[model samples]
Target chain A: MREIFKQEIEQLGLDLVSMAEHMSSAIDKATTALEKADLTLAEQVIDADESIDEIEQRIDEQAVSLLARQQPVATDLRVVVTALRLSATLERMGDLARHVADVARGRYPEVAAAQGRSYDILLDMARQASKVGTQVVELLRTNDLALAASIESDDEVLDRLHEQSFQVVLDEDEDLTRQQIVDVVLLGRYLERFGDHGVSVARRISFLVTGDLTNAVAMVAETSPRNSETS
Target chain B: MREIFKQEIEQLGLDLVSMAEHMSSAIDKATTALEKADLTLAEQVIDADESIDEIEQRIDEQAVSLLARQQPVATDLRVVVTALRLSATLERMGDLARHVADVARGRYPEVAAAQGRSYDILLDMARQASKVGTQVVELLRTNDLALAASIESDDEVLDRLHEQSFQVVLDEDEDLTRQQIVDVVLLGRYLERFGDHGVSVARRISFLVTGDLTNAVAMVAETSPRNSETS
Candidate 1:
């Protein structure tokens, strides 16, 4: 019975890693679609989010089943519960990637970003978001604490880029239209939230590794930076 | 043993209702703060969120404890797991309310919503969101399937208000400043998501009362409408 439980737990981790990989791909493709105004790639990303959602549902069922069959206690129980929460976070990350694609699709013929600096800033934000997405996959696959710690700094980079995107709109000299300003605000927000959810995944993994209840509690308590106007 | 499990489950339901009450109050205060540009009230809502987070943590710990101590299976198991998920949703609702308050506080001394028609639309969104929040509390307390069903229509009202807000910004005649436009977009998104979370809670409750796995699975599958541009 113990051996079976161990195997089930390992399988749960692998399933989560697979979900993270799909999420990473969605982020990369969404970014490229945004950069090039590629309608086909954008449509593909939009279509693919359904599969990510389905994966999450499957993981959730498996986790619940494990809890029912094994009735894991203490550390083992925490692992199962954390898996459930982590899958939800990954699912939300997929949704954020899809939102990015929506912005790309919404401005199909016209790129969402303004020309020159604003465009460069958006591309930079997308790159940072994609980088964070990759790191999330690596952290999930290997359980590397250092990699998990690095996710926070990567998220900080994304936050800075998001702020700069806003600055580009707020700058009096930029001369962006209202539509461009709205797109920039919404896009920056979506990408920044993607990075934030990546940090959330890392924090949860670290708690699982360290068995720190404080970390688990703090992870959920931290507000997304953009949501807090003071940030 | 069965009686003890029953009582614990009842306690979990009551705890959720308490959390929903806090959430409902936060929504009411957040809307009032936005309408009146009341900085102190906004600050109150923001600070109160920490307590809401604490309540969620407590509820989670209790639910986990119930699972571990009782080793409940089948329907009993689903009850505890659903409690855990519902608390998370309620916690997020608190965060959304906090975000709304942040917007109000950030624009302190000046209203987040522009005057005239734009102002009315934002207030309407807030009121609808507050109504949904109240209905969530009622559903948690009474397990009323009809009330659960009503939340969807309330969310629709919020969606319409959100779109009207966008139209207010896009209308050439409105002449909203860039900052005002950004505020409107962010606020509308926040309120819409609040309504979405309320609908999620309602669906989960309905699933619990009806013992319908389809409702459980389908609830999370529904994407927030505004996230899809086609909506």
Candidate 2:
């Protein structure tokens, strides 16, 4: 019985990692579709998001059932439940990818790129976000506290890229309309928030393992817009 | 022991309601500050958000303890855990309010109105969102399935108002700089998403009471931007 329970929980972790992989690819394709105005890729990303949502729901149910059946106390319960919340965050990341695809699709046939836009910067932001996604799966697999904690540091680059993307758009003097400007703002916000959610999952996993969150609070300061508003 | 558990669970419901009340007011003051560009009120909202985050964390800790100690199964388990998730959502609403205040504070000395924007429509959207917050707390206290279900119907107006807020911004012919345009979009989105979280809580509470989610899915269609993009 003990072995079966242990295996089931391990499988739960695998499912979470699988979902993370799916979400990472979705964001990567989403940005590609956005940059190139590839309707086909955009549609694919949008259509594929259902799978992320489905997997997330499945992981949630599995966690709940584990809680109910095993009634695991202390560390085990935290592991199961925090996995559930992290899955929700991952699901949100997928939705942000979908939002980007939708914007790409909405501006199809027209170059969706803002005038004087930092196209490479935006692509780099997506890559960094996807990297964080990959690192999270590793964290889950290895329970590597060091890897989990590094997301905060890595996210610093993503935050700078996020701000730079906006600066690029804002500084442009040529043919930047209100709609395009709003889209750029949304794009920056989506990419930055993607990193923020990534940080949230990492911090959560680290806290789950070590019960330390000093780094998480500091990290949230850099990524969260609300936190930045006052300072 | 059984009776004590039931009462403790009931108290948990009350605690959630209290947190929701705090969130609703934060949003209220946030919008008022935005409209008046009242820096003090905006500062107040920003500073007070820590209390919301703190309460949410305390509630989370309490819920974990409830789950660990009660070892509740099935419906009882659902109640405790879902309450935890809802508190997270409610906490997010507070963040949205903070976002609003941040925008207000960021645009000091300026009126901070969306350019050629319908200020009343935006204010009305905030009111509707706060209304949903109040209703959800009531539903939690009463287990009023009817009240829970009504959020969908009531949200339709908020959705329309959300759409109109954007249309007014888009349709404007005045000199709306890119920054103003971006601010309007953010304002509309934050207000609309605020209500979406409220509906989510109401829908979940309904599901908690009677195990029906068909309504919840339909209701989300009106508010979630990702859902609208594909449809």
Every model's TM-score:
0.96, 0.92
Against the native chain B, each candidate's TM-score is 0.95, 0.88
RMSD of each: 1.7, 2.6
Which structure among the candidates has the greatest TM-score? 1
Q: After aligning candidate 1 to the native by TM-score, how far in Å is the CA of B86 from where it should be?
A: 0.9
DockQ of each: 0.55, 0.47
| Residue-level lDDT tens digits of model 2 in B118-213 | 566777877787687678668767888788778757877777887776666556475566566666666767777787787788778777887766
lDDT of 1 at A104: 88
Candidate 1 runs further than 4 Å off: A226-231, B226-231
Locate the minimum summed-lDDT window of 10 residues in model 2 chain B.
Answer: B222-231
Off by over 4 Å in 2: A118-120, A172-174, A213-231, B118-120, B213-231
Candidate 1 global TM-score: 0.96
Error of 2 at B105 (Å): 1.1
